[model samples]
Each structure stands twice: as structure tokens, then as C-alpha cells.
Target: MTHQVHLGIALERAGWHPAAWREPSAHARALTSPAYWRDLLRTADDAGLALATIEDALSLPDRFEPVDALRPGRVRGRLDAVLIASYAAPLTRRIGLIPTVTTTHTEPFHVATGIQTLDFASRGRAGVRLVAGASAAERANFGRRDIGVDVFPASGRVEDSPEILAAFREAGEFADVLARLWDSWQDDAIIRDLESGRFLDADRVHRIEFEGEFFSITGASIVPRSPQGRPLLTVLAHQTVPFRLAAEHADLVYVTPHDDADVVAIRDDLDAAADDLRRDREPLRVFADLLVLVEDTAVAARDASQRLDEWAGEPLTSDARVVVGTPADVVDAVRELAASGVDGVRLRPARQPADVVAIAEKVAPILRSAGVLREDADGASLRTRLGLTRPESRYVGEKVAL
Candidate 1:
């Protein structure tokens, strides 16, 4: 197939594996250090990976569990994902830095400006993974909304839960507000004409008076028009509600497909959602999420995975499929995914630094050689590299109309 895969890595504190921090190569102690993040991102940047997504959440890791029932040995705590991405901006170039921004608790205005600032900091290589905060524990931190007693009722599918559906709906509106805010200032709004003694053209800025079910955001973004105009927006979707949200607002959507059938089914669902919504933008770019552990040999990789699972006192389980194998094995899996019509794969390294290093040094080369991975487009913005156009502001002529 001629379709080139967009490879991305998901960065967690130590790694996705609960016992990853126990690994010798894991930078457990340096989890909060900038140097650690710098090294990890530099590795991906040098390897020609398309993007790196920094995961975030309001509550501590494993907050879903009761305090007494919380697992003890797992890696806990995290620096702000946006700050981490911003810190890595000057440290590397090329790879897109997408930080998770929980929409449930954050103000849309803050979200827009913060990401716009990141776009400026990264020179256009910035994106955000918009996620909704679901945990009651997480909600307690903000105390802004009451999502009812049963966050995920035991009776129905978690995604079908009323509170969960409401959260996704709110998140969709949140995304809409962000888009409006990002476009409030026209690209040429800043004239910088010193002779005229004017910094900006008043007619070029428009106020977005948006009032939604969850949020009401007013006016232009505090930040200027960013390098990519509106930076890339992404969402991770596992169910119909979220798929609809992604279809409506995301430039890219990360999905978990356990098999070839799943890949096709999920793609169909996303397409159906976009069609149903009458989405006029480009079709959402689909990236399958995978928890990966790679080694020189298949046996060795499985052994490592088993060892990590043993350390954690349970086998590794994830919403995404877990792949434990050699580089060649990974290439084969990716080949299958590509044939199944996935635009890309975002691998969550089972062990930080170690698994990520292996992915960059080993798996990436084979994918490139096999023509599954795309060649690097040097000095391209994240949107350009992902083949997405830098969009024009939706409110371009609004001031004139008024």
C-alpha cells in the first residue's frame, strides 16, 4: 500500500506499564525533571516520529480506586502536560507536541490561549488531546459540577452512562468554544505599524459571544494568532459519544482497535459519525493506540512484558491492544493495521526510555524501510507534517459585517 503511516508516541510519567518505574532504564526519579523529558522527546524528534502526546489528568494516577484500595507500587504523580510540552519545545524540533488538556474542568478560554501559546513556543508544532474528566475524585478537585453519585453506573456500558454522555457533550461544546476563541483574532490583526503608532487593527478582531450548555466564552483570545492559526485538535474516542465529538471537532482521533476487524469497524463508525454530523471539514485522521513492548527477539519481548506484569502483581491490561514482540513483529502488526486503513499508530511504550528507545532505534527503521512510515518533512509545522492545512479564521469578515 502507498499509504504512509504517521507514527506517534504517547508519553506517560515512567511509561504506560504500572511497573515501568521499577525497570532499570526507566527514569522514575527524574519523572518531574525537564532533562528527562528533553531526552525522551529528543529521541523521538531525532527518530523522525511524527508526534509525541504527553498524557495528563487532574487526579493522581489510579484515582478511580478508593484511597485504601489504591495500588501502592505503581508510578504516581505528574507534571502539567502542557508545561511539559512547552518545556520540550525549544529542546527539539519536528515532532508534534500534543499535551492532554482535560476539558471538563478547564475553562475554554484558558485552553485556547494556553495551546495558542504552545503553538508560538513550538513554532507551530503543537496540538492538544482534548479529554473529559470523568472521575468523581477529579471533579472534587474543581467542585464546579456535580455528575451524580454513579459516575459510571454498573448497569450499562460505561460510555452509555448518562453522566459520561453529558461530559462528552460538554467537551464537544468546549472544543467549539476553543475554535471560536482561536479564530477571534485575524492573522493580520497585528499591523505593527510604528509610523502610524498603532499596534493592531481594531476592525480585524471579532468577539465570539459563545454560550453553551457547559461554558460561556466571550471574545478574542488573549494571545495573538498562532503560527498554525488554530493548532491541531485531537480526541481519543472509544465509543459512539466520543466518536461523535471527535468527528465534530478533532483534526485527528486516536482509537483503540484490538484487531483488523476492529480497525475497520472503528473507521466505519467514525466515518458514519462525520457523515451524520454533516461535518464539512476534512475527514478525521485515525490513529490506533497500542501498548507496545519490543525487544530483539519475540521471546525476549514477551519475557520482559511478563516480568513487568509480575512486578506489578497483575498482567498488563489496557483499553488499547498490547503488543509484545520483536521489531519485525511490530512491523507486521503495523502492516496489518495499515492494510486495514488506519492512518497511523500511536504506540504507548510499555516501559519508558527503554521501550521508547527500542521503538525509535529499531521499529521505526524497519517501518521506514518497509515503506509503512512516511519520510520526514523537515521544518514543517505539526499540521503541515500531518498533511492538514492551516485553517483560515471562521470569523474573518465578522467585524466588517458588524
Candidate 2:
């Protein structure tokens, strides 16, 4: 294949629009409402998107250095991502519904079980987006003991650099342990044998007693092995070391390519990591994420961009690298990113349903003509559509290479 592409949408809380709640199409009710998420997933699935992520996030008040901005505190958001996906599961057929769950506060036991439930409810189409936040406001929602800022390594950490390298190592190890916990149960352990009056095969289950500097999680899961063995594990990484996590673990990795040139660097780095880790499994699927406002004309898109910036409390700065252009221009950017060695993209719409639908109608056709989209996208389960194999039912055996 020349390239592979999968479309995914993250239902960001209110989607970067302060006035989104006031908009007619925007949900005025709870974001946690089943109906609201169901509609969004249905729309995205109908439009050929592969995944619709119901991302749960505890928003830290947007820290403002200036005196006049909205003071930092807990912002508006309250929804459990895993539960939302579970509820949305029976509502959609083809689209994979992965929800965000933080490893920061959530236990591997609970998180692993939740994803397994999602896989069952959706008939094996569930994935999890794992994110770790270091903000005090977000930590407040967890309400355990206080996890000070130093608990997580500071940003810009390097081997010989300023930030605490140990902290990054700790967090990375925790994530690895979380993934292992998700697989602790053997697939066949959950044999429902009413005839024999026996419930499960205990010997098949493995207990993991992983003890690390930052954490020490013990043994087998309360839930049976998931249908997917492990649902698609996705992680977002902005820098080099973080990207290494994706290289070793993630089925999908989302990164922002600074330019066409940057795509090469990201791909090369990931490839090197895979080789270093000796992971000769599937080919790595790297995807570029861009916030975009597509319009009939470049100027029209620019106008929409400016409006969003105004809502963001300032003109959009260089910090958020968003694509603002006509469909043709946006197509060019996507094509370039794909050529720079990526499987696909997770396009962030600058606006609401309009931009999303517009991209599907306009930009997608261009990609189709370019032959980047996969042919198997039609008439397949999310796994089959992604060109991934259907895993053995949660009652199988495996060899673990230590």
C-alpha cells in the first residue's frame, strides 16, 4: 500500500468554543448524556470515520500569566470517558469508539475491566486513549492524597537536561504496567460451563506482581481477558522521549508535524525505537494531527480561524499550529504529511459539524482520488477495517517473551 489512513474525532469538551453550548447544534444538556454521544458517533461513522473518541478530561483552569484573563481554576467539564463509550457502544456498528482514561488517577484494574466491557458491548470494537496530566486542578478531582507537581517529571526532561528524567521514567513505567494488567487474564479463562457447574479456569490466568520505583501493581485482572486480547492502545506524544512510548507500545500514535520536514524526523525516530526495542510485529502506524478550518476560499477559512482565536481570549498564536485554508490547500497539507510517512490523520475541526462534514465531503474526495484511504474501510468491523486481525476470543493461550 502507498499509505494507510484512518479518520478519528476527539469530542473535546465544548470543542475549543466558549459559546459552543449556546450554539444550536451543540448539546445544551450534559456531555455525559447518552443521546448526545450516540448522535456524534453515528454522524462520524456515517461519514466513514474509523474512530470517534469520547475523551474524558479533567480540565485545569487555563493558566493565564496576565492579570485580565480568566483566573486559573477548575473549568467546565464532568463526564466519564469510559462509561460514555460503553453507553455509545451498542448504538454504532462500524466505528471504533475509544474513550480517554487517565492512568494518573484510575487504577489498572478498573481501567482494564472498563475496556473489556466496552469490547463486549461493542462486539470487540473498543480502544483507549491514555493521557497523563500534571496539573493540580485536574489532580484535585482524583481526591486521593495530593500528587504534587514534582510527582510527574517536568516537561523538557532529558538525560543530561534540566527536567527530572526519573519522573518521566516513572510515568512511562506506570503506563507499561497498565497495559500489562489489561492482558493478565487468559482468553479461555471465562468459559461459561453451567453443565459442569464450573465458572472459570483459574490456571489460565496469570497474576503480574510488577514492582517499580513509582508503582507496584499486583497480579491478574478481575475481568476476563478482553476480546481483542488488548484493545487498541493509543498514546499522544509531543516530544522525542514521549514518542518512544508510542514506538514501543501504541497501536496508534498522534503527533503534530511542524512541517513536511518534521514528518520525516518523527517517522525515523519511531522506526529507530522499534528496532531498538526489537519489536518486529506490525508495521508502525504514525498519524499527524492538525487543527483545521476548511472553507470555499482560503480567506473564508482564515476568517473562521480569527473568530476562534478571539474566543480563545487572544488572537491565535503560533503555539497551536492549525491548518487554515481552502479544501484544496488543506488537501495539499494532508497529502504532504502522508508522503512524509504517516498512516493517516486525526483532523481537528476548527468549528463544529459544519467543518467535519465539509472535510468529509470536500477534503476526503481529494484523498480518495489520491488513493490514500484504505479500500477495506467498507463492510468490516473496526478491527477489520483498520486492517488488523480479529483477536482470538478471550479464552486463548499465548507465549510471553520476557
Candidate 3:
């Protein structure tokens, strides 16, 4: 297959737009249904998309707080992202399944093994999106420690307060621990030698003594080496700390750039951060996140967006760029971002199934025609597909070549 732009879809309950559920095609009550998630993954797989991210949080949807007194068609609840991915893994093929998880209140040991389990479940087509918790309500759900939202700044910069910097620093260390734990067991550790009566080589497993200001752990992960060796690490970031975290650990990062200049700036920052850290791994794959309202024609797409906005009684905006256009127009917009060195685009559909179908049936064909999308997944692991090598176990001593 020729070189092409990567494509992933961020799947949330109902859709991204607050008013999306008001759309005729929205499944307002199917947010927690296993069948709903399964069908969604199947649809994405059929489209030959690279991956799909299941959005999750520690708490209920804060957008609809006081859940009983919510809007008519708002999505209220969410199933566990990790569980959803695992449930749908066997039911789908090709597309990678990435679940969002908050690293703040969760254990790195649990995060490592959980994602490793996902990689096994999905046959190496698994990843996790690490997000730092930024809500007081979310903290209450954990009750683990007091992580105030004030720790994160309004500017998304780290140079301001020690608390914010500490949070990011903790996040960075957390990511490091996850990676180390993932490599704690060597690939050939599982001997399964019946004659020797050894299921694994004890020496192959190493302990990871990770001690940080926020969290500490001493032990290797309970889960064995997964199919991917180390599953892909992903983060969505808009600023320096997160960008640095992504550069240091993430195989892929989702960024939202407002314009070509923003794209250039973000890419430059990523490169600089990687260089500053002396990261020798492959360049981080940067995918732009866009909220897309796609239809057969640009006019229709605009109408759709406006109608959704009308339902919400206000104009809609987002942290990510929101594009309302035909499938071809959407492709053009993505190509423009790609020109600015973006590796791919992760489309957040404004409405489920309908907008997703537009992406798969319409936008994907256009990308394929332009030699920018592969016709099939080619049975490659998600990390392989993303051009990442199977990472060597850090626990293993380096073998010297004669």
C-alpha cells in the first residue's frame, strides 16, 4: 500500500455536539448498550478506518449535571471505555480500539495491565488515551485524593504555578511508569516448557521501582507481554506540558489546530519538546481532531449544523475545529491540515451512524482515490500500522552483535 494519511474517529455517547441527540438518526437511549458500541465498532471497521476512541471519565457526564434536570435529548451516561473496547473487540476486525482513561486517580499498574489486556483482546489493535482529571466532581468519584481542577490553568501552560506543573510532572512520571511496566516482562519470558515444568522464565520478569512525588509502585505488571509488546500510547493535548508528555511517551497524539499557523506552531513545539527530552523514538504521529458535520453537499451540511445549533438554542463551538461541509469538502479540509505536516485527522462525528456513514462511505472513498487511505487494514497490528516498531523490553540486557 502507498503512504496515506491515518484516520481515526473519536466515538462519544450520541455525538460531540450537545444538540446532536436531537438529530433524527441519534440513538439517545443506547449510550450504555453493548450492542450499540459493537455496531459502532463494526461500522468503523467496515470503513477501513485506522482506529476509534471510546471516550470515558471517572464520573458521569458533567454537561448534564443534576441528571434529572437535563435537556430533552442529551446523552446522560457512559459505559466504561475499556470494557466497551473489550466487549467489541471480538465482534469487530481491523480498526484499533482505544479507550480514554484518567491517569490522575488511577494506578499506573492498573493502567498498564488494563491496556495490555486490551491489546491482547483486540489482537494488538488496542491503545489508550491518557487524560488528566480536571473536574472536582470526578475527584469525588475517585475519593482517592484531592485533585482540584485549580491545579490546571486556564491558559493550559505549566510555567505559572507549581501545582499545575506538579500535575503535569505527575502525569509525565505516570506515563513513564506505564511504559516501564509494559516492558517489565521480556517477550520470550513465557517459556511454557512442559518438560521443564516452567510456565515462564522467572529471570525474564523484572521489577519496576517507580517512585514519584504523586504516585509510587514497586513491581512488574501482572499481565503478560501482549501481542503488541507495548500497545500504542496516545494523548490529546493543547499546550506545553501535555505536548511534552506526548512527545516523551505517546506513539500518537491528537491535536486541535485552529489554522495552518496553529498547525505549524504545534508541530514545531512537538519537535522541540522531543528534542529537548532527547527522545530517540520515531517522530510522534500527530492527528488533528475535528468535529465534522458531513453531508452530500456543503449546503446540506451547513443546514445540518445550523439545525443542531438551533436545537441547542445557541451557536456551537468546540476546542477542536468544527467543519460543516460535504464529504469531499471535509477531505479537502483534512488535506489542507495534512499539508501543514499533520499525519492524519481524527473526525468526531456531529451525529452518530449518519455522520459516521458519511465518513466511511463518502469521505473514505475520496481519501482512497487520492492515494491517501489504504483500501484495507492489511492485518497489521495497530502499532505496526502507525509505523511503530515492537518496542524492546527494558528489562532485557542488550545483546551485543559480534
The C-alpha lDDT values of all candidates are 0.86, 0.66, 0.82
User: TM-score for every candidate vs. truth?
Assistant: 0.96, 0.84, 0.93
Please report the TM-score between candidate 2 and the true structure: 0.84
On TM-score, the leading prediction is: 1
Supply the TM-score for candidate 3. Answer: 0.93
> Clashing pairs in model 2?
187-394, 187-395, 188-394, 188-395, 188-396, 208-219
Q: Stretches of candidate 3 above 4 Å error?
A: 1-3, 61-73, 150-158, 374-377, 398-402
Candidate 3 residue lDDT tens string, 14-78 = 88888887788987777678998888888888888999998987766452154244445556667
Which number leads on lDDT? 1
Residues 34-63, candidate 2: write the lDDT tens digits.
Answer: 776676677776767778766566543542
Query: What shift in Å separates residue 98 of candidate 1 from its native position after superposition?
Result: 0.1
The local lDDT score (0 to 100) that residue 255 gets in candidate 3 is 96
